[model samples]
Structures are given as structure tokens and as C-alpha cells.
Target: MAIHRKRFRVEEAIVGEMPSPEMIEEAAPMHSEIMAELRAIRAQMAKGTPPAPLSGSAAMAAIDASTAHELSEARTMLETYRAQIEQCEKLKVELDLIHDAIDRTKREIATLHGKSFDGGEMAKVNGELGAVVGGTEQATQQILEAAESIDQAASAMSKVQSADQQKRLADDIQERVISIFEACNFQDLTGQRISKVMGTMKFIEQHINAMMEIWGGVDAIKAHVPAHVDTRSEDDKLLNGPKLAGDVGHASQDDIDALFD
Candidate 1:
């Protein structure tokens, strides 16, 4: 079937004024991306075969179908955008939590630095520990000297036959024993100094534990702990110092002596 074509010249009428140049300039940037996409669509339409003319009812039906298809695509795109927005919101919340955690940790670390390092608490601890060591060394030396004197006097007494010489040796032994008793006073001083150090250490530990809690807890901290490496030389490694009271897994003095035996 052939379709009749008609041509007519239409007079131009002023229906409305064009938007101001300022408004056009403002909207141009906003719609640039949309304009680009529309141009692409127009190019594709120009390349495709044209559809045959339709009767009134058929054209209406075709229009309805096209509208429904476009609506479906728009709905799908809206749903995708909504899912993306929800995901972005969730990620933002997670980031906020992480930021809060970092801030808390930073605050705790600063506080720890101020209290332990800047406030001289650590210096006080070191001074107290050093004094304890110095006192212990001096006391040990005094005790050793007194023991040597007592041992000499006793040995001399065993050999002496005269009552005057034996009596003199006994008197010397008594004086040495008194010196040994006096040297033992370092233990009391050491205990007091150690107590002060322990108090400072406890304060630092509390802050560290608070930071651990901010992240998670001990288990979380353990996950980040690096592998242990004994970096000390063999001799330094053996010098673990005196074990703390109630500490297990360390060799006792007897165990060490038995090695030689």
C-alpha cells in the first residue's frame, strides 16, 4: 500500500522568549553529560531502519509499549542506584567507626606519653630501680666480706689450742655476724623501691589496656603481635636475671647446680 505525502509552509510565531544567556550558560554545564548521551542516541537512531507508518490504534499501542519499556529500564536503573547508595551509606558508617577508633587510640597514646614519658614517671621508675640495684650490690659485697671473715675465724679457732686465742676468734666471729645482719637491711629498702616502680608500671599498663579495649581486646592485640625473636647473643640470652617470685618455667639454682654434677 502507498502512503500520500503533503507539504505545507508554516508561519513562525513568537510563543515564548528564549532563556537569558546567563541561564543558558548556567544550564549548559549542568546538562552537558545529558546532551552528550542524547546525541549518541540520536546518532544510533539515524543509523537504524525506520519503522513503517502505523494506524491510530497501532501507533497508540506502540507508544504504550515503548513507554512501558523505557519505564522498566528507568525503574531498573533507579533500583541499581538505590542499591549503590545504600552500599555507600554502609561504607560511610564503617569508615566513621574506624575514624572514631583511630581518634580514641591516638588520644590514649598521647595520654600515655604525657603521663609516663613527659611526666617523668618512667624516669622515677628507672631511678628507683637503679638505687635498688646499687644497694643490693653494696649489701652483697658487705655480706660476702663478713662471711669470709667468719669463715677465717672459725677455721683459726679449730686449729687454736689456747683458750685465749679461741675466745678472741669467737669474738671476731660475733662481730662479723653482726655486720652480716646489718647488710641484710638492703632487702627492706629494695622492697620499698620496687613497690614504687610497680605502681608506676601499673599506671602505664592501665592506659595500654584501655587502648587495647578501644580496638577490640587482648585477643585482637595478640593477632597483631609480631613473631618473637631472641635477638640476644647466647650469653645475653642466658642472663635472664633473677626470676620473679611464683614464676614458673625458669630453672632453679638447684637445677643449674645439678647440671655440673
Candidate 2:
């Protein structure tokens, strides 16, 4: 038995060493021609037919060049994407900081007011208003009842025939008028009480504004409050004070009565 050795040469292609421009230029035409021919052949062939083989050094070089180009493009794209992602993260952090600032503002404002949205000051104001209303209502009712009594007395006095009876009736009328005048005194007292209540409300409002400044404003208030759906329309948002009793889309006294009925 005879053993034969096949010898191959080793070419040292150092770092950064690449195929010559001449070789690449030479390979280009052949590569284009071959690719064009192959494409034509594939076009002529039936569907699913295996394509022709390309196996020369030039063909390999061309493939390598193409692959390198694709890799360069992919690397560029990856760097761009990374930069974009970094920017997005930065923006997100800034947005978070803005949110924090807003929350802080709201908390400060809440403090100034001595209360929050459903704060103690508001409850106190509510109680005060209720007391004022009750007092006024009671006073008005008493006046009405007194007036009715005066009317009854006048009607009876009108039917009297004697001078002495007339004199007595006139005296009773003066007394009733004096009683009416006394009933009106409640108004002065109620006005004073209302003025006190108004002062309290102003104080509460000023404190609330101070709280806003302290907390960071609306943001802080919202953080402490639970999220609720805003059902008001753009128009409704501008509305102020109590709505009319029988307004559209609102339940009136009749509707309330119907619940019990």
C-alpha cells in the first residue's frame, strides 16, 4: 500500500487585511452576470425546482462582501435603536419627576386650607350653614304664625259695635304690631350670625389656598384621593351654585316623594 500527501499553501491574512480592490472589481461583473443568468433560469424553471449551484472563489467572495454589507447596516440600525431607547427612558424619568412635583404642590395646598377635598373645615362650614338655615326657617315660621293670629284678631275686631270695644281693638292692634316688630329682630341676629359664618368660610378658603402652595397643588390632592370618573361635560364643568329644583335631567320633589310612595 502507498500513502500520498497533498500539500496546501497557508497565506497569512492579518488583522484588517482584506481582499484587494482589483480582485473585488474582477469579481463584481462575474457575480452580477451569474446572478442575472441564475435568476433567468429560475424564472424559466417550474415552481419548487432546486436552483443552480454557484461554487467559484469569486462567487464566494461576492457572497462574503454582500454579507459584510448587510452586517454593517444591521449594526448601524442596532446603534440607532439603542440611542432611541435611552432617550425614551430619560423622557420617562422626566415625566415621573413632573408627576411628583404636581403631587407635592397639591399636598401643600391642602395643608394651607386646613383640610382637603372632604376636609374638616368643609364639614364645619356645612354644620354652620345648616344651623343658620334652621334658625332662619324657625324664625320665618314664627312670624307667619303671628301674622295669621293678627289677621284673625283684626277680623273679629271689625265686627265690634261699641266705642269701648273699638278702643280695646285698637290697643290690641298696636300690641300685635309691636309683636311683629319684635319678630323682625331675629333678622338682625341672623344677619350677624351669617356674617360670622361668611368670615369663617373666607378663612377656610384662604387656608386651603395656602395648603395648595405647600403641597404642590392639584397633583398632591389627587394622590390622596381615590380616582373617580368625571361625569361632567365641558359645559357642566363651568356650572356654579345649586341647580334649579325642577331642572331637566334632575329629580324634583315629586320624584323624591315617589321613592317613598
| Candidate 1 runs further than 4 Å off | 1-50, 156-171, 229-261
Query: In terms of TM-score, how similar is model 2 to the real structure?
Result: 0.43
The sequence of per-residue lDDT tens digits that candidate 2 reaches over residues 1-261 is: 333333333333342445556667779999999999988878867566675677798789989999999999999999999999999999999889878867866665556444433567667667777777887787777778777877877887889888898787778777877777877887787787778678876766776666565556778777889788979997886564455866565556687699998
| Candidate 2 Cα outliers beyond 4 Å, as residue runs | 1-78, 101-105, 116-123, 185-246, 249-261
> What lDDT is obtained when candidate 1 is compared to the true structure?
0.88
RMSD (CA, Å), candidate 1 to true, equals 16.3
- The lDDT for every candidate, in the order shown, is 0.88, 0.74
Task: Find the 10 residues in a row with the least total lDDT in model 1.
Answer: 4-13
Choose the strongest candidate by lDDT.
1
